[model samples]
Structures are given as structure tokens and as C-alpha cells.
Target: MKDQQDIVDNPPPGGSTGDPFTISNSLNAAQTVTVWIAKGTRWSDRDQVKAIKVVYADGTARVHGNQTGTSHSFKFDSDERVTSMGIWTGDRVDRIKWETNQNRTFDHGGWGGTEHSEELGNGILLGFSGSADSHELISLGASFREDSD
Candidate 1:
């Protein structure tokens, strides 16, 4: 097993102040990561999570997200990395959480922005961003766990 430790906790922006918010993070190795968005943030009639983009070890990427849900979670293979994520039609996430390399999970609040990011080891960067008309970046403060083999 690998010794997992705190990678990064890129705090969110002050508040949801504009449209097309974005956040990002970097990774040191291929890790199994779960991405989440706070509840009450995604509404069918308003801004909802649009997509999540994951870059694999080979440099390819995949986009995924739920249009109707309080949160969305996905797993990245051991050799893959979650490059970026975002939501639409809504602003402010009650919480943002992620666990990498099956180690301790890291979380943060005030995670609202058109574009946000953090630098990680091995020259990796991760964050999230999105654009919408009826939205303002806001903080998030809830959490959920996701496990995979």
C-alpha cells in the first residue's frame, strides 16, 4: 500500500460573484478519486452539475456528470487523474470533497468561482469551473464517501 497524505486544499473563492466558474487540482500519480458537489446546489430547473473531466495516465480524458442529483461521484483508475470539474445554472456548492490514492479524504468550503485551481506534487494541477446565466459561485460544506476496488 502507498502512504497517503494531504495533497492540497485549494480554498474556494470569496463567493459566487460571476458566471462560468472553474476549479482545478493536480496529482502525483494515478489515483482513485471521487468528486462531489454540495447538496441543494443542483436543481432541475436551475444551475445543475454539467460535467467532470478526468485525464487518464495515457493523456486521454473523459467527461461525466449528473443533470439531476444533489451530488455526483466517480472513480479514476489508479493511473488516472481528475483534471477539472464544474456545474451550471447554479452557483455555490455547500461542500466539496475528494479522496486520492485511497488515503485520507480532503475537503474545503467557500468553493465558488468561475475558475479555481491548486498545484499538486509531480507537476499536477486540479480544479473546477463552469459557466451559466443564473449562477454565482458559493461555498459548500457537506461530504460523502465513495469506495472502489
Candidate 2:
């Protein structure tokens, strides 16, 4: 759905009442970032599919798909990356996968019918159904885990 007005005004459980779903972070390097959304039973009943949009450090924006439960990736090339991410949905996302370059990866396999939060690595923190503005913080809905090398 192209209309963001309705989603902004009456957001779902974890969404902001008037503000859009926004998460931002500052990164140390230019990296390939990937985000994934998994389809759930709630997706089938709605006419609008949930979407994830990403705003790079350079102010350019990229928009990614309906509730198809797939992975989407983009590149950020700024010294101090200011990456903003948002998810728009009428229900819960089954799973979310986030990876940065090859340095780190955060995976939230699925949601088990509630909100939760988890911390990954020294800088990555995630919150279920919420907002975050740094690598040390994140707010959204998903089961959490971290991987690094």
C-alpha cells in the first residue's frame, strides 16, 4: 500500500501512534546491510502488506516489499553512517534477519506471540516492537541472537 497516512495515524501494537516505525544507527564502516521479514498468519488477512524502508547515511532512501517474508539488502557508504530503518505493518513479523558487512549479524528467528528484547555483541541492542537510534540500542519485535567473526 502506498498510503502511509492511515498507517501513521493508527499504528499497530508496537508502532508509534503518530510517528512511523523508525530505527537509526551510526556505524564505523561502509557495509552491506540486509534486513528480512517473515510472513505470519496475520499477513493473510490484510489488504496491505507490511513494508520495511531504509534510509542510508547519505539521506537516500530505499523501500522494500510486501509481506512476502524475504530478505532485502542495501549498501551504506558513509564515514559515520546514519542508517534509519522502519517497518510498517498491521501485525507481528514472524522473523527478522539483520547483517552488517561480514563483521556482525543479528537474527531474530520468529515471534512467539509477545514482545521481547535482546542484546547482541558489545554494541548491538534490540528491543521488540520499539525504536532505537544506535548500535547499542534497538527496539522492535523478534526473537534475538548475534553472530560475529
Best by TM-score: 1
Summarize candidate 1's per-residue lDDT along 50-97 as a digit string, tens digits. Answer: 333444355545333433333344545544433332221224443344
Q: Model 1: what TM-score?
A: 0.31
Candidate 2 ranges beyond 4 A from true positions? 1-30, 45-68, 83-85, 93-149
In model 2, pairs of residues that clash are 127-138, 127-140, 128-140, 129-140, 129-141, 130-139
Give the range of the ten consecutive residues with the poorest summed lDDT in model 1: 140-149
- Can you give the TM-score per candidate against the true fold? 0.31, 0.27
What alpha-carbon RMSD in Å does predicted model 1 have with respect to the real structure?
Answer: 12.5
In model 1, state the lDDT of residue 2.
22
Residue 147 lDDT, candidate 1, scale 0-100: 21
Error of 2 at 75 (Å): 1.9
Give lDDT per model, in order.
Answer: 0.35, 0.34
- Output the lDDT of residue 62, model 2: 39
